[model samples]
Target: MVVEEREITVGGDARPARFTSYDVEDFPVPTGREEEWRFTPLKRLKGLLKGADADGKVQIDVDGLGDGVTVTSIERDHPLVGSVLSPVERISAIAFAGFTSGTLISVAKRAVVEQPVTVTLRGEGGTAYGHLVLDVGDEASATIVLDHSGSATYAQNVEIRVGANASLTLVTVQDWARDTVHVGYHAALVGRDARFRSFTVTLGGDLVRLAPTVRYAGSGGDAELHGLVFADAGQHLEHRTLIDHETPKCRSRVAYKVALQGEGAHTVWIGDVVVRKAAEGIDTYELNRNLVLSEGARADSVPNLELETGEVEGAGHASTTGRFDDQQLFYLQSRGIPAVEARRMVVRAFFAEVIAKVPVEHLRDRLTGQIEAELEGSGV
Candidate 1:
């Protein structure tokens, strides 16, 4: 119930939103009616706070992903930028005060970078405010790709920091441009024996919301999260994740795969794991899987766990949603191999263990050609 923290100005520099000095408060408020943000369709999150007090500007196009990626205009008190003005940042701040000059993609400590650092957020008009900060030091290693395809319409905020015994591999591809409207927020911090890996591939967008948060503060830390999403016909794809072990010999893992086709497509998945209480020797796991090819496509899966104290050594969570298994499509149409390439070879073997952990082989063959063009427009 403490909401009086507002000073946030970008290109001319200003700061007051301390995000409660990182503990972030507001009486535990972060609602989409809770329950892990209840199926994530908050009327498209009320149009991202309706223009964040106007004064809009979003037109930036930098061609041919080249040369250590440089585009700098920071100085809104630039010390790795800031925002998330409490009220628990309206439950995970998504473009809080519309952006005013940002783009700081860095890598320079033990620098072992071989290509693979592409950040593309091409938007023109409407609402486009983005903030990105990625710094990986200490024994450094890197691979980062964030591509929000052309034809802009937007709200995006991203923050990433991984140092101390550092290692980071991040890949996010949101195929934007279908009269776009997107709200995104990603925050990650991992240190001391650090290792962080995240991969998300979402096909096209009409209305998309993605919130990815990961924190494993030191103590032999490690974290890995993988996700693949495919939504067709008048699309809507939403994903929310948070895995925090907060110290004491940490480790985390999460896996997500979703597929839905045709008529007003919608796919939603939420996975959250938190083990606090000083996180004694923790180890965590979470999983969610869904497949519903047609019949007016739709899917929803929720996996959550919160353990304050249990002197944790291991923890678990899981969820599943079903469809597409008419006896494995009649045993592949009785073996003549004609049931549309055997249902695209069983949805690519149920998405080949999250696309074989995509360490960039042409972005895993361009995400397996957008999952076989959504199974040939779902005639399969």
Candidate 2:
């Protein structure tokens, strides 16, 4: 279906509606005038917006493939690709046009995976384009972990399609180098009675932007999006999401938490949810909370909800940004903990609720350690 494609005002500039275009010609090079590029540091993008190619500079390595999972490296577009979502930005279109090969993952029907599929993308240097397509068979359940590290200017697209009654859990960890710049588009098509969960943790990067979109194909679909960001000195992190509720009896919940510290730290979160007139009896809500741990950090959060009809069950949005809880820190300090330790305790407690949901034990431990390290470096 063609989108309404309205433009909303942001900082006096117009922001394009969700699901704009899939063609490269439809998206032009952004000059930082568009609403999407206004918050991002386009000057630090390293010419990625001009449609740069990889030129054999980046390396993508994958490990930990569970049983009943088949992987393929296809150089051309497959039937399953582009089914759920399309490229809505210029760099994402460039990544779609200049990919060396597309990774295709297929899970067998009714197969339960014992281990999570881990894919590590190491950026040696230079610019690169890439894509990934995951097809989960009916009644199948699986977990995938996509990890990024090292230095590079990269753009890519990810599409996940779940069959009816299937379940998919995707965890993306962006642990890039302090000089890396990466942007990617991720979208999922949830089927009837299916469940989709997306968890993202952003730790290191000079500038990183992630866009995730969701659309329900049938009734009784459910989607949950959770994100964690820890930005330090001289880092810029951005995340935007779109949830399209076109079918009845579908539900979506979004929760993104972030912490900023040190000089030149910045983060942005944009949440857009649209419920069509035909989508009756739907339940959806979005929440974004930012914690400023230091003096020089900045965080921008916006949640937009558009409802065509009021026949839906419930719909709402919330956004909050503030400093640390001094009372919580005082409570910890009064309990015999040192001042620094008390601060660390408060920071950890802020993200403990989200970290505890990691189904992978070792990965959860790693995330906890990373959070603790961030707290130590915060100097708060």
Candidate 3:
């Protein structure tokens, strides 16, 4: 395959160009100096960047199979495997080339699924490669939850397709073991007049890096992406997002929040949005916020917005990283609340906006409990 490169002007400044290819050999070994790999700890990747062979397996399970849903296995060379996603980095390309078969979940046309579908992937140990695809037919509606657990070094790719006039709500939870290292790429293509909403929750793993990108297949498409990250001691969690507005009259919104505590806890968030010349009257915005709770913890946030045409409806980006607000804590303590409980309240309020938007009630309650547990364990 041919390598494609393009230059983009973001915030009136020329950013580094990016390339995409399907072949692993097209990408050079990252030296931790490139713009894309600068914030990542390459030494702790566990050889995923080198396209190492899988020595273990990841067991897959699915539940809530309804009237319109179909789940099956397909070969790597299946027609729909690479129809919606193209590899933009070495690890994703390596995963695409290494996996022999993948799981496909499809929804029939004009069907409505009342029950939410859940897919669980459990790892045994060692290294593994995997792929998954979710296809929503025209005029259909469905909700899906992808739950990840167990311990392993895993690299996977997920492709999603939303047909014309369809709606899809996807939530991906990463609750891996402390010894696991995971790197994944998720891409989605939204058809004309389609709606796509995604929520990503990252809470575990030693080193986890995930990239999610979206592209519009036709005009009048809408996309919204939300993420939550909580890192404990010695944990590294990173999320990179790209919203490419290539069609006219489309809209996109992105918001992500991070909370870091304990020594050596680190988090990174990169938000990139591009509006091509042909994408006239487009509206887009991205925001990222980080709160550091203790010493020896760090957070990095970068937001970029690019516009090729001046006829946009609105385009903007914002990123903020700082410690907790003293005034808020003081206000809570003055109300006769204990200091420890006040701190917990402040943290919960910080993440409440995102948590409240989750479509599942049980999931929202579970995530709240998990956040409380993190605060108690870290003695925040």
Write one digit per residue (lDDT tens) for candidate 2, span 205-268.
8999999888888999999999999999889999998898878999999999999998999999
**Each model's C-alpha lDDT?**
0.71, 0.85, 0.90
Error of 1 at 47 (Å): 20
lDDT of 1 by residue, 127-239 (tens): 56676777776767788888887655566667778888888898888877776767677778888888989898888867787878887657887888888988887688888
Question: By TM-score, how accurate is candidate 2?
Answer: 0.93
> Which pairs of residues collide in candidate 1?
none
Q: Which regions in candidate 2 have their CA more than 4 angstroms from the true location? A: 1-19
Instruction: Please give the range of 10 consecutive residues that has the lowest summed lDDT in model 1.
Output: 83-92
User: Model 1 lDDT vs. the true structure?
Assistant: 0.71
Best by TM-score: 3
Our tally of clashes for model 1 stands at 0
What pairs collide in candidate 3? none
Tens digits of lDDT, candidate 3, 253-368 = 99999999989999999999988877899899999999999999999998988777788999999888888799988999999999899999989999999999999898899899
TM-score of each: 0.32, 0.93, 0.96
Model 3 residue 129 lDDT? Answer: 90
RMSD, every candidate, angstroms: 20.3, 3.6, 2.2
Candidate achieving higher TM-score, 2 or 3: 3
Segments in model 1 whose C-alpha atoms lie over 4 Å from true places:
1-77, 82-127, 132-152, 160-179, 188-205, 209-211, 218-233, 240-264, 268-280, 287-294, 298-312, 315-317, 323-380
Q: Candidate 2: what lDDT?
A: 0.85
